[model samples]
Target: MAVQPVWHFNRSALAAIALSTLQSGLAQAITLMAPRQMGKSEFLQYDLLPHAEEHGWRVRYFGCATVSPRALTRRLQEALSDFAAGEKWLMRQFARLAGQHAATARAAFPERLVQELAQLRNEKKPSLLVIDDVDRVLQLAGGDTLLREILRAFAGTNGQARLVLSSTLTGHHQGLPALLQQQTTVLTLPDIGDAFVHHLVGQYHQLTRTKREDDNPFGKLSPYQGITWGQVDEGIMQDAFNRLQRIPYYFRALVEDLVLNPERAPAEALQVQLARLQRHRVAVLSWEEMSRLDRLLLTEVAKGTRQFYGDTLRQYLAAQTGAARVSTSQVQSSLKKLMRNRVLGQEADGRYLIIDPHLAAALSVTDKA
Candidate 1:
C-alpha cells in the first residue's frame, strides 16, 4: 500500500520551529491560537508531536475536550512514575528514599505531579505536555487554576519540561489572558492562500483522476491517470478560493462534497452546500438553546456594547430580564456559555464582541425589525 499524503502548511512548519527553539530554563509556554476547524489540533498531533519525539523528547498529548484536568493530571503522574522506573538508578534511589512501590509514587496529586516532573530533568532530554483545545479545558470548573499550576510547575523546573497549549482565539476564560501574558509565546495561524489552494486542488484532482477526458463517456479520466494543475479549470479554482476563504478545512469539505455528489455542477453544488450551512447555523441554536438571560446578554453584546464589565453585564441582564437586579455570578455564567459556543469572543483589551459575523448579522437583522 502507498503511504498517504499529509497536507503540509506554512503554519505547521512554524509550529515545529517554535517547539524546537524552546529554551529549557525559560519557564515559557507556547500558545497556538487559531479559529475552530483550522487544523491546529491536527498540526500539533501529526506534525509537532512527531517532530518533538524525533528530537528525543517524551511527549504527552491530552485532548482537553475529551479529558478533564483532574484526569489529565493523574495520567501525567503515572507517566512520570513510569519514566522514573525506566531509569534503574533513579527508581532505586526513589525506592530507597520512600520505601514504597512505584504505584505509590504514581498516586501523587496534581500539584505534586508537576513538582515531580519539574524536578526530573536531564539537559539532553526533556518532556513536553501538549494540551489541545485548551479553551474547552478552561470551561471545566477550576480548569484555569489547574492549568496555571501545571504551567507554573514547568516554569520552575529549570528546563526540564515545556507546555504547548492549542486553542481558538475566541472565548473568555478567567485568568487565561494573564497566564498567556506572563511567559507564553503566542503563535497565530495565518489564513490559507491561493498558492496552497492551487496545490491542494491539484493534489486532489491527481489523486482522484477527476479531470475531463474525451475517451470516457462521462468525460472523466481513469483513476490511474493523474491530472496536472494546468488541466484543472482556473475558474473553478478561483471560485474555490473565494468560496472557501482560504480555510483548509472548508476547502476539504467543499472538495468532499463535490466528490460525493459527482453529478452536480461543482460550483453550483458548492454554493448550495454553503447556503445549507448558513441556514443550519441560523436554525441550530437561537433562543431555544439559550436561557432568557443568556439571550439578553447576547443581545446586549450584539447591540455594540463591546466590553462587558461584570457589573455592567449583570445590570443589563437584570434590566432586560425584568428582574430587579442580577448577580455577577449569573451574568458570568451566561457570558462563559456564549463564549464557549463561539457566539461571543473576548478581545485583547478585555472587551467582549460577537465573533461569528454570520450569527451577528442574522441577529442584527432580527433586531432592526
Candidate 2:
C-alpha cells in the first residue's frame, strides 16, 4: 500500500473555548495541562495558533523542550525578533541570521528581547505567545530566573501579549501561579474523542482498498492470514482505541501497523505496540533508576498488592532484599520516593499503581496468577 496522508482531528471547538477565555478579559494567561503525547503541542500549533492568527492576532511560538536554561532567552529573542522587520523579505533575513547567531546570541539577548516585546506591544494587533513545555524549565538550574524574566517582560506588556503555556502536568513549580502574576486559566487537552477514531476507520479503508493479494503480510500458518482489510470497521477501531487506553500516539501506531499488515487483530497489534513501549528509552531510563526495593514494590503494585504492610509482602520484601527483617517503615519510605518520582501514583481510594501504562504492562509480566 502507498503512504497515507497524515490524519488530523481538528480541535477548533476547544480552540474557540480557549481563545474566548483569553479574549473575555478574565485571564491574560491560559495554561493547558495534559499527559505527554496527548496532542497538547498539536493543539497549540495546528488548532489554537492558526485560529488566533486568522482572527488577526500576531503570534509567536517558543518550545522549551529542546533548549537549555542559557538558550532560553536567546530562543525567545529569536521568536520575538521574527516580527522585528517591516517587510516580509526583511523578516525572513532577520530570522535566518537569528538562527545562525544562536551560540553567541547571549550577550545581546535581553536588550533584543526588550526591543522585540516593545515592538509587539506597539503593534495595534493583539499578540499571542505560546511557550510549550513550560514546566521543564522549572527543573533546570536557572529556570526560575528565566521564568521571572519572561514574567517581567510579558507582564509589562500591559495585557497586549497574551500568554498560553503547555505542560504535561500543571504546578510543576510551586511559584508557577505567582510567576505568571495574572488571572491564569488552566485547561486540560481533552482526549481524542470517538469521532477521530471513526475518521481513522475511514482513512484505513481508503489506504488499504487497493492492496494486492500478493502483498499480504500474514504467513500461511497465521490464523488471520485469510482475513482482509474489509473486515476492519468502526467497532474494531473503537475497541482498539479503548484497548490502547485512548492515547492518540498509540492509536496512530496501531493504524500504521494495520496499513502494513491489515489482517492483524487489534489486540495482537496492540501487544506489539506495548512491547515496543516496554523497550522505549523513557521506560528503560525509569527502570534503571529504581532500587531493588523500589523495583520489588513496583512489581507488587502491578500485581494488585494493596496491603503494602501485610506480613506476606514483608516476608517477600525481606527475602528479596536479603535483610534480617523488613519493616513497614522501609516499605513506606520506598513507596514515598516512587510516588514523588511519578513512577507510582495513588488513586482516590489510596491504592498505589504505576502511572505509565506501558511500564505497568512490562512489569506485570511476572505477576502470579
TM per prediction:
0.65, 0.72
lDDT by residue (1-369, candidate 2, tens digit) is 112237777789999899888877767788887766777887788888888988888776778887877776556555655644322427556656678655544666555555556666667888888889887776667766766666566656666778898866421222234544343577777777999898888777776754543345543354334665566778877887776667788788888898787667767887887665545514323676778898899888888888999998899899989997889999999999887876776765687767665566556755753
Maximum-lDDT candidate: 2
Q: Name model 2 segments beyond 4 Å from true.
A: 1-5, 67-73, 83-115, 170-183, 210-227, 279-292, 295-324, 327-369
Writing each residue's lDDT as its tens digit, candidate 1 over 1-369 gives 112245554345665676766754433688887765667777787777777776788776777666555686545444444443334436646674676665655454456655566556644678777878776656667767766766777677666677788776542233246666565777776665676666666656654553444336765555434423343355686676565544566667676655554555566756775665454443335546778987777767667775555676677667778999888677788889877775667777777766644455456766888
Task: Report every candidate's CA lDDT.
Answer: 0.63, 0.71
Worst 10 residues of 1 by lDDT: 1-10
Mark the 10 consecutive residues where model 2 has the least summed lDDT. Answer: 169-178
RMSD of 1: 7.4
